[model samples]
Target chain A: MPEPEPIADFYAVVPAGGSGTRLWPVSRAASPKFLHDLTGSGRSLLQATVDRLVPLAGEDGVVLVTGAAHVDAAREQLGLADEALVAEPSPRDSMAAIGLAAAILQERHGDVVIGSFAADQVISGRDGFEQAVREAVVAARAGYVVTVGIAASRPSTAFGYVRSGAGLGVDGAPSALHAVGFTEKPDAATASAYLATGEYRWNAGMFVVRTSVLLDHLARLRPALHDGLRRIAASWDTGADARARVLADTWPGLEKIAIDHAIAEPVAAEGGVAVVPGVFGWDDVGDFNSLAALLPSVDGSGTKILGDTSAVIRVESAGSVLVPASGRTVAVLGLDDVVVVDTPDALLVTTRARAQQVKDIVAALRERGEDDLL
Target chain B: MPEPEPIADFYAVVPAGGSGTRLWPVSRAASPKFLHDLTGSGRSLLQATVDRLVPLAGEDGVVLVTGAAHVDAAREQLGLADEALVAEPSPRDSMAAIGLAAAILQERHGDVVIGSFAADQVISGRDGFEQAVREAVVAARAGYVVTVGIAASRPSTAFGYVRSGAGLGVDGAPSALHAVGFTEKPDAATASAYLATGEYRWNAGMFVVRTSVLLDHLARLRPALHDGLRRIAASWDTGADARARVLADTWPGLEKIAIDHAIAEPVAAEGGVAVVPGVFGWDDVGDFNSLAALLPSVDGSGTKILGDTSAVIRVESAGSVLVPASGRTVAVLGLDDVVVVDTPDALLVTTRARAQQVKDIVAALRERGEDDLL
Candidate 1:
């Protein structure tokens, strides 16, 4: 099996942000989810995301956009060239981060196709991912905003849905379809109905579009944000002093909005969005429950241990998710589908069914002003 | 309320020696359950046990018998005189621990009444407890092996039962009754049936007997153990060197048996054991669930915390038992009746219903050679 060739004139933009409060004690504001190796694969999620993208977008063509606070840690993990990393002065959400990267990629390489992939996602089946990215790139060249819609494996209410209308008869991208619209996370009944229709896929927030197309849409819809991003991108390569001066001036004021709400939803409404079916396995690693699904069961009873198995002792406990990160032994007895996350300064004990409510615990700690634990 | 006078010639014998495996991580072999303040009260179980007995048996009449390893800690907590503390060479079960105390007390004070109270039980209602002890002392003086039979509040399979026969009708002891027999912890249906008979009471392992009377029974039933205990007691007061030499020679060879099997059950068959109703609340603090019942509810949800309440945070969790002894924040979300015991070296997460299975966790850890955690 020969190594696949890199896509022509393509750049991968990884926006590494979000504190991921749902994964408290492990994912903290100081070192968010992207900096941690959630998959137990010996590579941080940011490194893994870049590793998956490097083959599609050549090693030199991949760029990382993260908070200024995280630049040193991100640099240590990814080892990307200084030019390939974009440090935001402050968080302006996905729009400002990805837009700045797209504008900079266009300035560096003439009007290339750029795809925005988050730094905190887990991906498997690289071949299928590459296939979807290649098709989305071809569709992007046809002047449409493209997103790789993940194959919906379950009626999950955790993610928004992208509705595919009809197939786009584009050359070299037969899997591309006209994206009709996007829907926010639906209730269980509504999600089941959407799945039953077979036209809906989980909007994985993967967007591949020509720099000109994305910038054009931004200019038309969000002029202030577009102007702010273009000014930052123009001075981004002209030494650290000029970049810092411009970022410090314009970054904080840029519209803090998710890319899905900024472009995908509006572009799909105007019949300018294309959906490419992604057959690869994908997970946002949203919470402990989602993490448990990705981990290999340690025993016959489906117990999942995220760290050293030797540090955990389970007796009559089945389907438990244990993270013994504190260097202390964790013992779970006669509890099924329980979640026990042990850290040095804090501990969380809940059930897998109530894993989502872990964020409530973080909220409570925050309410009590326990910032050190957060 | 007036303070009660001390019982004449009464000695409180506290035999403190169980590892309490079910309360592991907190109740370690190095620092067993008796050393811990399981209740939110400032005093430890051992200290509390001695406090209750001091009112009934006078300050100077209290004797603490514990393992040699715990002698310093017991001294620090109890402040008992050197002659009053009995340090065992090693664990030889309740029979050796209590019988040795009886023999030593008899050797020091001729034919005195000594009440053997375990050093790990929690008791409420001081008046009721003192009254029961007074009656049991009277019965013991009348040549009966007296045991305080706690009023069975529930059909608990965790404790053995004492069947009371007709009243002893002894002078100055109005509530003394003949203990017909003892039954081991029974099945649920059997326990319920025992409760229905109105004659059964929880055998709280409280034995009040004349030193001569108990020694006589020990000599007739198990002469070798009695002789070994008598030999150790004879040299116990004859300087540290003599005591150590005699203990090393005799302690290892003594029979390792519980007092119930050694004297109580067999003596009851011979119509010698007497039951004194203990209306005071009592618990052995055997496991986390039993400990929960002894604690006041922290919230309307019936949550119980054994350490710093501020160190714990609960959300949508009801009837949970939390022990945040690690000086770390413990957060439990959306789990009912769950048990989370966080210690510095180890953690235990289970449910209240499954609290008994915590011993299984200790066994598993022991099997895995994690003796430090145990």
Candidate 2:
């Protein structure tokens, strides 16, 4: 009935990256997936991410780590203070991004517990999300690197899987269990078999750990990268000149590694990782088909529209997804399970059955040297 | 081989109508099918029709019959003089449009043998078309209402069929034959059966007859419509004011009947009609499927584009008809036999198998009162 107050000493780190090549024209390199309102909720995914985090981390406790090119857009959309926006000079992948944020929090806020969430994910059921994050914070306080593993509703091969072992039997977290290991995206048969076992959950890449804990693990696992990130974090809050000098000197040399591989998997192998079951509905909106799944069906025919419903006209076309972003009328006839995304500069036509192949279109565009569209 | 000289006393009547709802977005009511270049041949279909006819009838001998709303575009595209353009106040179907043209040509040029060609049809093999028109004109001078019947290439259920009787043996027109009867668009089974007998040919509605003969037949078959057309024709050349007033008064009262019902079927039944075999390639460009059939394939995969080829990017889609009229990049992925039309104000997505049902989208648009899009 009522939302819980902000957790004390908890900070959120939103690492915004990825061009979403499968989503194509809607998610261009110039304006990526996190900046788009894929859910028709009137707020971009980045803003929605911050909105979800503010209840747990408080207004001033959330920091964003994004590319230097996107810092202005991130600040404009989130209305974050300069100190709260960490602009990466260039992409060194997730390990450097999340590690730098963790080290900087350790420097400025004295080893506060931090949770890393992606800026482009879609989640529903606020109570379940908050509850999962609360349990994750509890495990983090117990000195375990915690991950929020989403309930596997279907045998989907689009995401990695995290296996749960014995229950943690910890005090404040009843849903916490020992995370045995992590696996990359598997084949359909393997995913189905994984679903058959009740021990697997979708590894949504949500990690909550003390800033000092993550830094210490990074120092032992990837010492060079960890030392480089610590060097950049030392001057992050000093002055513009010193911060720019440190970022220019150290960020380029950091290792390009995902947090899952560098920290989650290795530390997970040592039995120091814990998993909290997240019953909330979640999606990364990786493709147009996934974005369609996030939208509410507009009619009894299962037609989904991301933009103005009145702009779409369907005849004998059931289960169609239409995004009319150019203020133009979209008419779909005699086609079932069709996807039509009509933007100003580009239009995409495909079927839901073959939606995963849309990345091929982007590749084709790239091969044709149509960089402006990409 | 050199081309033939213009035939003496031969005039051409071009009727440009039909919204082509099946080719929506590319063929809107404001700029119907004839105004579009469905073949990507630089010239609009109306211009191509006139280019084909100018050799049979002299450069100044072609008359265009179209709605008053489209007269300016037709004139600009055809480069025709004011007297060569016949603008109807409103649509009264094919009979009034063609009959009025006949009456006007009779008043101005005196009993000239005229051939009626739709402005939207695509034809190939110039020598074959010229030979067919030459034979039809000879039969028309012999006092027979003549029609050029396209050789049925397939058992297509999309068009009407004409049955040919015994040969006419008319001089200078060895290919002319007596017309038995005409059948409306039939079912697939009926069409196949009709093709099995070697007598049926596609009725393309290309009529060649002396103005006096057509008027006499119209008067005998439907006197009221003939009188109304004659009344409009008499004032058509009097003055602009008188022409407009007469059209407003008489055109609305004319019966809305197709030439087939009003003359061709009745004349054929009475053994007064003749058929000229058209062996050349021909298509009405009736829908996206037919349009695809007319375009040259951009690749061995059978993908067809009716606009700039560079504007379309196809991946794993075969036999797709794409019209990128909006100057936007259109990417189609993993769809076979799909039809995508991207225009400035509207878009259409469908499959070639369902191309005939595209008119249902127009109906849906009208039901939504989206007249601007239509």
Backbone atom clashes (below 3 Å) for every candidate: 0, 0
Fnat of candidate 2, please? 0.99
Worst lDDT run of 10 residues, candidate 1 chain A, spans A350-359
Q: How well is each residue in B200-306 modelled by candidate 2, as lDDT tens digits?
A: 99999999999999999999999999999899889988998998888888778889999999999999889999999999999998999999888998999898898
TM-score of each prediction: 0.98, 0.98
lDDT of 1 by residue, A1-374 (tens): 99989999999999999999999879998999999988789999999999999999999989999998999999999888999988887888898899999999988887999999999999999989999999999999999999999999999999999999899999999999999999999999999999999999999989999999999999999999999999998998999899889988988788889888999889889999999999999999999999998899887999999999999988888998899999999998888998899989999998888887888998999999999887
C-alpha root-mean-square deviation, candidate 1: 1.4
Q: Which stretches of candidate 1 lie over 4 Å from their true place?
A: none
Q: Under CAPRI classification, how is model 2 graded?
A: high
**Interface RMSD, all models, one decimal each?**
0.7, 0.8
Provide the DockQ value for model 2: 0.90
Scored by DockQ, the top model is 2
Backbone clash pairs in model 1 (N, Cα, C under 3 Å; residues 3+ apart or in different chains), count: 0
Write the residue-wise lDDT of candidate 2 on A95-161 in tens digits. Answer: 9999999999999989789999999999999999999999999999999999999999999989999
Per-residue accuracy of model 1 over B145-226 as CA lDDT, tens digit each: 9999999999999999999999998998899999999999999999999999999999999999999999999999999999
